[model samples]
Target chain A: MNLALRDIRHHLGRFLLTAVGLGLLLGVVLSMIGIYRGLVADALGLVRAPAAEVWVVETGTRGPFAEGSRIPGDTRESIARLAGVTETGSMTFQSLEATHRDRKLRLQVVGYEPGRLGGPPAIAEGRGLARSRFEIVADVKTGLVVGERIPLGGDVFTVVGTTRGAVSSGGDPVVWMALRDSQVLQFRLSPAPARREAARGPVAAGAPDTINAVVARVAPGASVEAVVEAAKRWKHLAAMTQDDQETILTRSVVEKARQQIGLFTTVLLTVSTVIIALIIYTMTMDKIREIATLKLIGAPDGRIVGLIVQQALALGLIGFSVGASLIASAKDFFPRRVVMLPEDAASLGLVVIVVCLVASGLGVRLALRVDPATALGG
Target chain B: MTGDNPRPLVECRGLAKHYGEGETRVDALRTVDLDLWPGEVVGLLGPSGSGKTTLLNLIGCIVEPSAGTLRLDGETVWEGKWLRPDLRRLRLEKVGFIFQFHNLLPFLDVSENVALVLDMAGAATTDAFARAHELLDYLEVGHRKAAKPSSLSGGEAQRVAIARALANRPRIILADEPTAALDGERAGIVMDLLRKVAVEQSATVVVVTHDEKILGRFDRLFHLRDGRIEDMASRPGDLTG
Candidate 1:
């Protein structure tokens, strides 16, 4: 009779209805996992944008995101001079606002040398920083069009090229300009500081040579850790390999929030486990008479157990399929991007298989306890 | 095949079953003796609470007797509330049962319901279905082989049940009120079908019933009263159509 399939066929509406309900709960759990992935992707995008093999910052601090790191702008020259260093650039990051009519745009301004490693990694349209000081290459997220003019800090720059997914770890669209111009913009003193510098007269009319951090790429086959150690020897500086920076960004920067969301996902999955167990147990209970009859007819114990386990797994698989579809379709509706990987789905399937087997335990116990004589009745 | 040493298909001596412990213990069956030979169909008659079903259950190996012995097809299967260790194997290989309800698995078609017995007995799929089809054809329900139990008429469903009981080609068929829910005509059809399967398949058949109308079909009738067989009558297929 293929008992499991038969039972499902006999009660398909009820089975599908329960699966949908379970699927929604599972969908919420899968969504939580997707949000975690998005958080990592967004956080790492900026760190990965430079593709720098090593970073040099102020000594004893984690990195730019976790702490302030200011080194002399001229340090890029020294870093590039190192034996195995292939390329070098000094960069600055700061949040700035520009008013275009009544709509204000918030962006993270990035200053990088032209024709160097620190510029926008890829261009989606137009070109990269065609003119230097007055031209800007912007992320598509900025809602600006090619050749458009936007005024920022008393100077209007032309948008020459566009990039996709070029945002800061904090999700602000990135705006690229020449390193020198960024230095001038970022190092601008507040009125009080400018007044204090003015008191010292023309001696300080020119800004100091300073930058947030220096980024470097190591030669192919050269160890980045060795380069970092060489840079860190400069007593006034600290250096981190790319992997260290990734850790600091995801672990130090986003770990706490990720863990929080991860906790909710775990809770939801636990609830799913219990709910599946209950549904299977209830289904088994409803068919107690049939089970007893089968037992009385001398069906083997393994056969009975197989029926319960198979039904439980069928329920789990259908629920997961529905939940995965729901998460995939609804991802765009979420505020943050939701990344669902195929590997993650495969991994979740393994876990659900185990959960289903464990869930069937309750039903198997109750079924085995049934007296076959019950089929004869009182 | 009829010789002095021809083995009995089923034999029970002083078979007893009791329920409860201490002061509340009661005997559901007590010290009953009986014998069933191959190709014999027996009917057990009794009123409510007379332990007719209890004796049938013991004979079918679904329950253990509290006292005495049971041998099936020349093998001693029970002694004093203890059943043989291989009881499940014996039951699967040698026993068939029909209940008051048709009890065909509702999700399966008539053929699958019949084939399930051989499947459980570890028969190959093609062989199981082939035998199932043969049985349904013999029972005159071949046209309904693909119909699920829920859609089948009463007579058709019971006949399918009869087909299932005969699926494993068991040595004995124990039917408890097989016609309980059927009209007279349908009951007569089921009884006739069961007798035909019993004799043609060469299995001893035991029926426990309160219905007097179908009494004429049995080769021998045992009347159970207060856990004892009160009478044994031999008259074969008097109601056979």
Candidate 2:
């Protein structure tokens, strides 16, 4: 037992090299796990921001992103009159591509009234949107810092504040602006379309005076389900709890992205397992003659197996530690938030250990098959 | 020579081993009988393909014989079936083997390589290290205990192997051309060390060698030819005949 560990310590350089290789592979696995968690966090951030108990959207629609949701802007006024309706605010959602500093950036525009029920909850830098029409608060992911001017439709809005992790279900950075700007950005007609509309004279854009959806807060001890049921009685509207809205966003808007990430994670894990197995197998093969000699000299089978397994586990632990540290330090450099939770790291560590043990099986078989007589022969 | 002791340390009766079957079968050992007692150093002199290694391997319990009865320290080790399922444990507790190449683990230092055998046999760390140091001192290699095998000369490495063999104080020691890789002076030193250890420990030592220069040191000698024992001499200086 002492001899095994002494031998490994004596050959520290080789072991460290093997461990480093394993560590890099483990880093990729950890990063994949973190990215998946980050996706879920990003999707939930928007719903969590409002601090609203229930949501009102068009009937049979998933949410503001997945399906077209349009209800009269005044629907909030009606919902506010209901029992247990503490407060209500109208909000609009749209994804737009705009130019900033010769670069085209895509953003999910969230429009709301300042100091209202639904708005940018917290600012990481500078002030929140103070003016009603031209000021905007942007997520840092949009690469727009404070005072940076970005064109939305035909108007240029100065970035008044920067927030973190404010992304839509599709991972687009969320930019908060005044409700009128969002409505105009989403529904405003181009010059030619405006001319055509003017020529048509009396043609009315359906629900021309309405905003997209109403977000509402319920009073204490009020049943959200009752309010949602009452809102559904309107012919063109539906109401949902905050949890239901999150489910809609996850299942409808980000389903494909989630599947893509899931497939990628599976592939990376398989590759990591195979890589670890090959390395352990190769190391064992290099020591075949030595193993045979050890067995011939009266070393027990358990000791031999222990040596191999110890080496494998050492490799995994060292690699995982290095990989975990690397991912934690480098996560912020990534384009998306890599949420490395302790539970995720703990589970990944266990998986790496299992991978190492399974990988050592090949080497164990090779070792057990060695004939002690070979040590006696030429 | 007959003594009051009922069993020799090692005894083989009509041991036969054949490789392959039918027309292609070749006899590696054929009906050989031998007895080795404690405090005796014997030399096996043979040409190539003369079953010297095969006989050594059988005595070392590395391979099974087709037909034979082997007794070690009054216990029947191999008859119709193996007396012990743990052959490795048997080897560790009762026998020591030295090969032509020093065969020291390159990753281990001199003392560690020697102590490894005792450690494998479940000896305590301090006891194993003390025994290893004692053996190294006996072989006059104690000063180089911390050096790796790769850093040692041919003679020093072989001495380490000898100390390793004696670490467990086995009843029988099998040396297969242990001095084959050394020059005349180093080979003589290794042979003298083997003789001294054998006499001091009262353990049986068997050396299989093609070297004729050091044949005079053994208490007995056997000459093998074509997988059969041809001659057995009781006197060491009788090789002139």
lDDT tens per residue, model 1, A92-202: 877788886568888888888888878888999999975657788998878898989998877788999999877776667889898877766665533567545635643
Model 1 misplaced stretches (Cα beyond 4 Å): A96-106, A148-157, A180-209, A220-226, A329-333, B1-5, B81-83, B235-241
How close to the true structure is residue B179 of candidate 2, measured as C-alpha lDDT?
Answer: 85
| Candidate 2 lDDT for residue B209 | 87
- Lowest-sum lDDT 10-residue window in model 1 chain B: B232-241
Give fnat (model 1): 0.47
Docking class of 1: acceptable
The per-candidate TM-score of the B chain, in the order shown, comes to 0.90, 0.94
Angstrom error of the Cα, residue A205, model 1: value is 7.8
**In order, what DockQ does each candidate have?**
0.49, 0.71
Enumerate residue pairs that collide in model 2.
none
lDDT of 2 at B46: 82
Give candidate 2 regions above 4 Å deviation.
A189-207, B1-4, B237-240
Q: In Å, what is the interface RMSD of model 2? A: 1.5
Q: After superposition, how far is residue B99 of candidate 1 from its true place, in Å?
A: 1.0
